[model samples]
Target: MNERAPATSPEVLAAGYARCAQVTREHGTTYYWGARLLPEQSRRHVHAVYTLARLADDIVDLAGPDPGPATAAALDAFEASFWDAVDTGTSPDPVMAAVATTVRECGIDDECFTRFFGAMRTDLTRRTYDTWGDLLGYMDGSAAVIGEMMLPVLRPGTDAVAPARALGLAFQLTNFLRDVGEDLDRGRVYLPQEDLRRFGADPHARVVTPEWRALMAFEIERNRRLYREADDGIPALPGASRRCVATARVLYARILERIEAADYDVFASRARVPTVRKAALAARMVTSREPMRLVHRDRAALDPLGGTWVSDDPVVLLDDTGSPVGQAPKSAIHHDDTPLHLAFSCYVLDPAGRLLVTTRAASKPSFPGVVTNTVCGHPRPGEDLAEAVRRRARSELGVEVHDLRLVLPGFRYRAEMNGLVEHELCPVFVGWADGDAVAPDPAEVDDVQWVPWEEFRDDVLAGRRTVSPWATEQVPLLAGLGPDPRAWPAGARDALPPAAALGPAAEAA
Candidate 1:
């Protein structure tokens, strides 16, 4: 090196990036180690993005509950400064300069930051979130957009966008669960109030009660579901980027496991993956082929009813917004903490106006050996729910359904049978098999019966006879339509869930 570059040369950019890296290392060890596997240029861009987010988050969060007008003005100034640097491609502030450079080099969209800063500003005054949907609204801006910002730098295929956003949401949700007590001190509640009321959990008590455990179990499973969503996109990345993201995913997901291992007592102690564990994970990711697979697979084996990887054809998984976040094997998703999924139930009718019901095969998984609706099953990925109903009716009962009218377009429920939970956004249907004989497949149905619709409805309503949880809930609603099953009005086609609004209309095939 005959001559060193002046500070006015490329060294200025290098210094900014170096400073960004130092900030990342100090504040975000998870990110710091994850980015280490990326190529040099890419790694610096990642650090710059993290530094920008970290600094912005500090301005909002560190202001305390009473942020007042001053906090908003300060945040506005920080954002304005960043944008000015972005437009000019330079800044006196080292972190802003590095971030602006990364944005210019990677072509990161300014809209992502707009949404992110909007969300940060929301935190200034918003004290609590009312529902899962409401909370996701905030997370979409604060967390999901950050993933969007990172996508260009990570340089995976465009298909990875949804998964990347899912990873962002998953990471933030984990942080919320782990830091609930800390968040309480800051006058924030990231957990949905609806979920808290449903489980009767009072996090403020800082005690590990049964309600809190149940609530955390539901949330942790949801967090893991997002991780699975994110995993779908990892293989799309180039080698080192894939390794870096995988390492980060596994390490972050492990925090959920830690919360579980500590008996869901998050308030008692902050759950974490130790620094040594993080370093070891990073090392493993570097040397291993398919590092993500082994960690998730080992964790899946811990599930009481196996894991959500039982088939090559995956079942679609939905978030609170009813969007397809990812897909998983149908066989493994119906355990005690079953995540939300798409499915349908059909009531088969004969010419004599009798509703066909069947007792499930004893060996079958989930609500087995119980008398329920004529047919019920998950729609295979890309297969319409109406098509699924028609398919399931044939395979399970050896009959083809005609007049498959969707009777309940928005039916959802959570029920337990023998401690195994079944949950689904199952649309209800009414169809007739016409002349088909009552031939039940021994593998799917133990017995079949055709009871008058009124009798079955009254039986369930009066509790004189027991049936599947969905059947019990459905019969009452089905009865509300009319006396004659054939005369029941079909739900409007447009009322179906978005993913289900596909294939042929709810008409006779």
Candidate 2:
């Protein structure tokens, strides 16, 4: 068990809440919007739970190149610290303190939190479910745990657990359906294997066919059944909380409808419920006076497995902060090592020759306060430079280019990122826009804006523009290429040195 001092001060709790609100507002509007609907007194509690979950989820999903080991270690330490805080009745971390308060206030058991952590840990290993039962089990631990925790806050002394679990499965299934292509591209497939097999489909197999469509339809129908089952528990909830749950259900269910509208072609494109549709769903909730129906279809499914798999051995917390309890005592079993690795970045320039930059979202691992190029991402396993660049440009910028000129090939660069050795053999490409307006992906590019090329170049050279070291190195090289409309291989150029090494006389056109 990790040992840490408890946070009892009001200032620390307030600061923690503020940080939670700020980070959640930037990365997850869905959660932030839901929190806003809660009563003022309950908002902090909800935000605390969201912040902890968000941080844990990002530790696995957004830790950047090779996050596996680090993410697992971080989660382990977080869980240890969380339990220690609960025992001591105080936490040095503000977020943990708020969570502790919420747990106590709402009578939230350790099972829910432990189950949530268990689900997150699955991200380190489980990428696909062998059966629909397996996928529902995953949802029961992940999304359903959240609903179970909220039930106490929303409607105490009520057996709304079964409905919450069903709703959670429905919500997660809808999310999986909508993000099929995106998840598949990330080396993840959330669709159940049993349904895929039943439809003579393999999610991992190359090329999606009519069989895949039938499989998707069957899965969607399963989600609809769960959605109906979950809706029964809503009326049992408090009147104020009922509307929010209804809205969330309607909003998520509409995503499934959108996927159906697209003819279940999730392999080719993603599905989304537009804002207008969301508004319509909310309106329907308000206008319709349908009484909440309570169903007791799957009581056993709702019951959490008995007993925890707790190891008697104590786990140490690696705080890394400069304090007595911060550093974990070095052990003979394992030692940390730093190794050199590669990274990827992009420079988004519009047809007007203006460079697009975005402020890093708070959820990102590096330079969250800093601004960087418009479209940037790390290469996935088995992906080459050109494919990685093209995929990232399309995914992040939401724009495809048919003519991408490889301006600089095989240019190696080295830099230290967050105390880790970063190495890359970058292949810079110049993509010309073809009257397609910019539609930056909010998940990657937080706030996008175009800066004039000459001004951007000057800023880079003059040290006025705060950009990534790699981007700082590539910007001037790209600017020198000018607005030449040439295809790739025809525009290959010699590699350039670091931006600082370039003299002022050479930088000025």
Model 1 — TM-score against the truth? 0.78
Candidate 1 has an lDDT of 0.82
Q: Distance (Å) between predicted and true CA of 77, model 2?
A: 1.7
Local error of candidate 1 at 346, Å?
4.1
Off by over 4 Å in 2: 1-7, 23-28, 63-67, 205-208, 267-269, 276-509
Q: What does candidate 1's lDDT look like per residue over 1-509, in tens digits?
A: 11222222377788888999999999888899999999999999999999999999999888887788999999999999988888877778777878888888788988899999999999999999998889999999999898899999998965789999989998899999999988888889899998899889998899999999999988887777677777778888888888888888887888888999999988877898999998998898888877666556645224443322222357778876566888877754665467888778899898888888899887676777899989988889889777788887877788988877887888889897643678788888888888648777787788998888889888999999999889989988998999888888878666666667555657522
**Number of clashes recorded per candidate:** 0, 4
Instruction: Please report, in order, the local distance difference test score of every candidate based on alpha carbons.
Output: 0.82, 0.60
Candidate 2 minimal-lDDT segment of 10 residues: 327-336
Task: Please give me the total number of clashing residue pairs in predicted model 2.
Answer: 4
Best by lDDT: 1
lDDT of 2 by residue, 117-163 (tens): 99988877877888766877888778888878777767633688888
